[model samples]
Target: MSLRSYFLSSAILMGAAGIIGASGPLQAKAHAAEVSGQPQPLPLPPALPTARDVSYGGTITLNVNATDLQRHILTMQETIPLPPDVSEKGGDFILLYPMWLPGDHSPTGTLDQLAGLKISAGGKQIPWVRDTVTVSAFHVQVPKGTHQLDVSYQLLTPVSPKEGRVVMTDAMVNVQWSAVSLYPAGYFTRQIQFKPQVVFPAGWSYGTALRSDGAQSGHTVTFKTVSFNTLVDSPIFSGKYFKKFDLTQDDKVPVTLNVMADRPEDLAATDDQIKAHRELVHQANLLFGSHHYDHYDFLLALTDKLGGIGLEHHQSSENSGPRGYFTKWDKTFAARDLLAHEFTHSWNGKYRRPADLWAANFNTPQRGSGLWVYEGQTQYWGYVLAARAGLMTAPQVEDALAEVAAVYDGRQGRMWRPLIDTTNDPVIAQRAPQSWRSWSRSEDYYSEGQLIWLDADTLIRKLSDNKKSLNDFADTFFATNNGSFVTSTYQFDDVVKALNAVQPYDWATFLHQRVQDIRDHAPLDGFSRTGARLTFTEKPSDYIESYSTLRHVTDFLFSLGFAVGKKGVISEVLWGSPAWQAGITRDQELVAVNGEVYDADDLKDAITAAKAKSAAPITLLLRDGDSFHTVSITYHGGLRYPHLEGKMDGLGAILSPLSGKISVTDHKE
Candidate 1:
């Protein structure tokens, strides 16, 4: 409103009050008493909202005005692209303006749930079809051309844990614009046209969708040309901000760091980070092809509390937390490692992408067969590229490799299942309350995948006399499969073909047999065990539990009577087996089987045969704690030992025994 209009309204209201005051108290009272029935004063006029101008297939504007705490007005105007099939068949389109939270991955909020709706098109008062308990999906039937559309509604901003409304109070809003209706499918989109222009209360800037319109002036700017695919992936943050380093290299992409925090020194840390990250990027570019982006920006968002998150994108990655490594670790080294891992994503997971996700749609599942390559190869390079670029020392890489190797060797159950299977499985077997814990115990895809890549790379290098490495194959794969938004259909096949072409060897069979199948024991024992040098082996000083005595007795029993069930759960006491031979019955719950209990300490002992046993017959006890009796179990024979040998560091070691004394160079052919 203008200053003149404000003055005029103020003067009218004051003049009316003065006229009433001028009427004396006695005269006013007499007049009120005489006027028994009179018409009420007319209500003030309602506020009018401004209409937005939209161009292209994405001209949706929402003016959500919440000047008061009770009533809010949400005005929407959108222009969406109709599919060719829909346009041909005269398909009806339903444009929905569903309410959603900023961080919520799914739009299932109750704010948009309504009993009725009122809608109009081009100022025509048309009857809006409504559904009970749902805000109607505005059904619009239009020809296949960009047309100006407008929608406006008044809604109540429901009170929430994050303080009433996310957008109004926080001065931040995440707007989603898609071609498909957003009512039923949780706001997921296959195609979107443009990023919406955001208007915040003055003095706030966005955290995401780094403005293509330049620095926002006076709290309003139009984000003119944003593709729909990029809209869903981008989230915006508007609040207080601090500027970090703005890195500009001669031939490389510029790096901008926006540090939003309460502290000023938070921006100071970027001095070293900018330098270190630039060096790291330069090093990676030297190894891999150019990281093709105009510029790269990192948003270092520091919330009030400690935060641990790094979400990646083509041009930017969000890094938020407390002071973090910059405040805690050796600033130089830690920053280098952190930057290397995140920056590597620009090439691998971001550009190279999984073949299965070539035509990925947000609402649907796109399962790819190349987790082994995408995740595994990415893992391989994260460390390899760092080492090659001199960002990490050779020993540091080897140390990291050993840690990963040990983790893989320890968790063989992951190998039992493919990287895909475990990912698809439910956290709980039966949708029970405690199912989320299932993932905690499951095998890590990245860890196992990395081991596979290492093994594959090693074989490739050795088979071709170092003439053909995995890197060559990867470059070809990227060239062949780049620009794909869905999963790659021929990535794996093409990679295998390229490998065979260059080496002229049947490596696909090797990959399928060794890498694909769990049973194929693609041995890593030959990969040098520098354990004695790199790791410590401190044997127990006193009486450590004895496995030798129990192994012999258990081996004898396995030969005689007991049977092992799937997953190593000892199932039955055989009819004439040693367990049965020792007077064990059908319902006997063995507490201490051969002096080993069903606990971690005892379980490891059972595997190692560390629990001591009687020289002759063994007295096994069954118990529901204190209420059970002893079942006499006599040992007869032995447990089968699955043993295999492989050469490493010019020396041989038994794989099953996992002896730490194996040579480190036995595998180098």
Candidate 2:
């Protein structure tokens, strides 16, 4: 790859070509061969693709039957109305299975699940072949009299939760078109139109943002003809037990809440939560100053039997959570900002998308290098809208900020890996399990993303002398002439320009430094800007407890630099934590502490006990590699946890955003 090596190879190739030209012309060539036997430059892979046409050749009708949940199978049949122009090229036709699904951020379409796939016309089966190179494509030669084609296939659903929880069940089902449909390959997704119909299990109710015609007898429903893009974006949920709630107010900006649960009691939400969701809608409109959907549907699944999903879309979101999602609202923590977060996506992700991510066809994989803005910015707004809507208290927000700082403050990965590098992990890693996630740093961009935007929001307030905030950036960046659903793409410079327009600064360098560089410390400057500083206290913050309880896991993660999951088993040992130093490793069981039975609380007490007496180390009986050994954790930093404390007279500025109350008190900088 050196310059001298490159020139040497180029001269040698030129001399060989000249000698071959002087001798004779080669008359024969083989597949993938160069005539003169010299190596050739490889062809590049496909880049970003755009839609060639916006009009469809004709409407295709697709019908699916997914009522057989016990068998975990879905049957699909489609009628293609092929026009003359479609077969203008050598009478060869190509069909494409949906790939690179929007919002899933990868080519997660269930192609391997396809079974018994066949295409036919004129009462005879047409011979078809799967393209060797592009596995998602099928090629068929149309006969002289063939004017249309019929396709049939059976889609196998996942029987296990780990494979994917998004499929169907006897109680309820999630219907994603990408799993059961295919379309002509020549046209763009938005140019291919489809009229879809579904027959669900009898006596089940379903909810989707798709424009529906009406429900027919016994669980059959039909949807209006829509572009392939729109149909794929619209997913449906059907449940034997279902309920609907209206979170709308004054008939303006209608936001509907559709809940489908496994049990009857789970459908009931308290009046207070109902009111807060309506306020969530209000704060979203107030913050972004725009609406992009005709009407929004917040489809929620509260289940223990089904897999969990939180995919965002243009008109609705697929949000599923643990059992007792509503009945145990007091103890369950998912409801706080689940709806608020997805609603923000309506404007930030679905309406205004990153330019590279806005591929005209689902065939082209969306480059996730910009998800730092797409998901990260939305995550920032999710927490803000939650607090503003009173779903989370001001204290909770402070605690959350503290945890964010403590985490990134010691994130071992940031020592080598930059925050921006995490954007493409969902695709690169296929969202797979990781052994050393802290060191590998799968997706710190979501949390660190919040920090960067937080700093910007605080910077805007300081630069404008409290004249404006991120609200200006939000309104200007997402605004449109109407609230109708439409998409506009933006680049990194567009975001920088918008931030600069709100309050002038070298935002380009500011962002690049925070995101594009590897730093030893966390981005804690957002705290000082908000008039607060991050400090650790002996007691755990509300954010820490809430996060741990929700995940059903505990974090000695920041404290001892280790985390334990269910049954007191060590899930991970941080690279340089007290646990790791003491020789505890992942998959090892914390059997006992100080000759007492081990539990999360017992470990905490032992740590506290070690601090009480400097000579006494926390003794742990760990089950490591099929053998039990006693280990000692010798550290004096007794019970350390993160919390945000107000800086000199800066409490007002910090509390204003959290509580929405203007501070009456004033003080020094």
Candidate 3:
């Protein structure tokens, strides 16, 4: 019989035997009546107070002591005055620590480092509770007639980089106010007033945008009163060794370059070096056609001890350089653009911000959908300004751009992910290391965004017969409210409008197609329009040599599809490349190359030798954890490093000096 007939007969027999019957529902219901343990989540507590635009009655006084270098601890005492209604009724009070920090674009507040928190009012201690949700908030019951509360806390700085950013060391300290203090939650940060005082280590010099109140008592200095927003925007860098240079010229606004170093020798900047920095300011002014801050400060730290940073603010920026920034300026060409990058942020990111990124308080989340313009354009201008100011040669800048182009051209992730989606990487990944970076695509908006702006600039130049470029857009978009530090926010439409004003084109469609669409190839039309092309050579460019020296890595991505760091450890592997196809992965140590102990040069020689014959394959012995494996990669492409060729007049015009007469100097050692 067929299988269906046999099943039907069995069902009939079972029904007759009472095995299947109409009482099935009752039996199932009886089984379902048994207990099954399950739990439901409890309702969350009330939300924190929303920030308002009203005034916060009185000034908040904050005092910080940062002398404990041995323990890497910074102690802070803050006094927050309550509003009239809160003081009279004596109900619930809330204090919020900054979470969504600017520049970070993520909730990176170091709440884990905050310890020894104490709150007192009217000479009596008050019990405080951390909110179940939004743990950055602290809730307390305020007693009637209590006008203010005294809060004390300690910021336990990381002793090593593995824990967090090392903000303090025996030689220097970086004091970010947001990391050390808390503020009332009900008012806008700009509506609250703050008076800050810091006690630095004795004999240490510091630089900050905060104007001194001229009230210094030995080691402590008091700063003039400022809004809470400004207090958080201004940070301090203090060190045992320091140097200051005046970059102000032909303008009422004062721009100073304050540098601190790990040693006194590292602070030695030559006259030419200082001149280049001054030219940076000049070129920036010429490009934007205006200045925002009344005065600007560049707080630079030349140290290997303190954690590296390149954060931007309205009137100042925090930057870190190699210990050999000035002492070995020729070799440190790779780091020369840091100051220019951060300085450009003063006009692009600080004065002109994305509408979605602006928030009333620091705890509110910031949307980074517009970072492509905020950071990407700034990055493009940074390289241009650096070359214009003689910080780097035109050739070096072209080489760097070639490297950027090659990287995006080889990015396998572009096939699946669009450039616009990578803007969310800051929050989605929090900069965590990924096993397949080439496939996952981490923060491509910065470099790829640079390419997009370059494409726009070249297109504008072409359309306007070299009469207009992104320079016009900068002058038109960011030059508003001259000398005013008030932030002006913009939306996607605003960007398109500004570009249209510069040179009329189908900018909306152009941007949408490039940013929102997934494609197999990178945006390379900019190079072609600029009379240059990305090409590969058997040898690396000077920029690549310097980059490799600084990073201590071998660049075999184009040939071997992998980059090996020091001690024969693999740092990166391109997805779907020959090495990847051979099962080679990152963090694996290359034990041998063709039966010889692994060496960078030896591997390169092996690759070169394998190119001569069709039957030969590059043999590699790799170690992953305790296991060992042998793999053969059939890549015959000899050593290939990206370089730019062809006429560079279009790029030269874009990178030409816009300010004063500046001579281009060769950056080669």
TM-score for each model = 0.55, 0.88, 0.93
Please state the error at residue 146 of candidate 1 in Å. 12
Return the top candidate by lDDT.
Answer: 3
Worst 10 residues of 1 by lDDT: 650-659
Root-mean-square deviation of Cα positions for candidate 2 versus the true structure, in angstroms = 7.5
Q: Write the per-residue lDDT of candidate 2 for residues 304-368, one digit (tens) a residue.
A: 67777888988898888766767766556534667777888888888889988888787877887
Candidate 3's residue-wise lDDT over 1-669, tens digit each? Answer: 432343356556755544235367855653455334344233345678889999998999999999999999999999988989999988778899999988988998999999999999988998887876889988777888999999999999999999989999988999999999899888899999999999999999999999999999999999999998899999999999988899986765789999999899999899999999999998998888787788899999999899988899999999998888898888888888888999999999999999988999999999899999999999999999999999998889999999999999899999999998998998999888888999999999888999999999999999999899899999889889777778999999999999999999999999998889997888889999989999999899999988887778999999889999989999999999898999898999999999899999998888888777574888999999999999988877889999999989999998899854222221111
Which regions in candidate 1 have their CA more than 4 angstroms from the true location? 1-58, 61-91, 95-192, 200-210, 214-217, 237-239, 270-272, 302-308, 331-339, 385-398, 423-443, 464-468, 479-490, 501-505, 513-515, 519-669
lDDT of 1 at 545: 13
Error of 3 at 435 (Å): 1.2
Candidate 1: residue 559 lDDT (0-100): 34
- Model 2, position 199, has a per-residue lDDT of 92
lDDT of candidate 1 at residue 418, scale 0 to 100: 43
Question: By the lDDT metric, which is better: model 2 or model 3?
Answer: 3
Model 3 misplaced regions, further than 4 Å: 1-37, 660-669
How do the residues 1-669 of candidate 1 rate in per-residue lDDT, one tens digit apiece?
Answer: 332344356567765664556567855764675596644343242221121222223334433322332232233333334444445554234444433321122233344523234434455533333222234344444334423334444444334424333232332232223211232212234334553555554565555544545635555656645554465445444444455466545453566655565454554564454565555555555444345345666555554332234545556665554443344323223223434555565666666665554443333334445555655566666666555545454444554554455434533343355454533322222112221121232324455666666666666666777676666665555434332333224566676787776566776776665455654233353243312221212121011111212111122222334433223333344344455556544333446656666342343344334223634445555653357666654442333222212323211111111112212221210
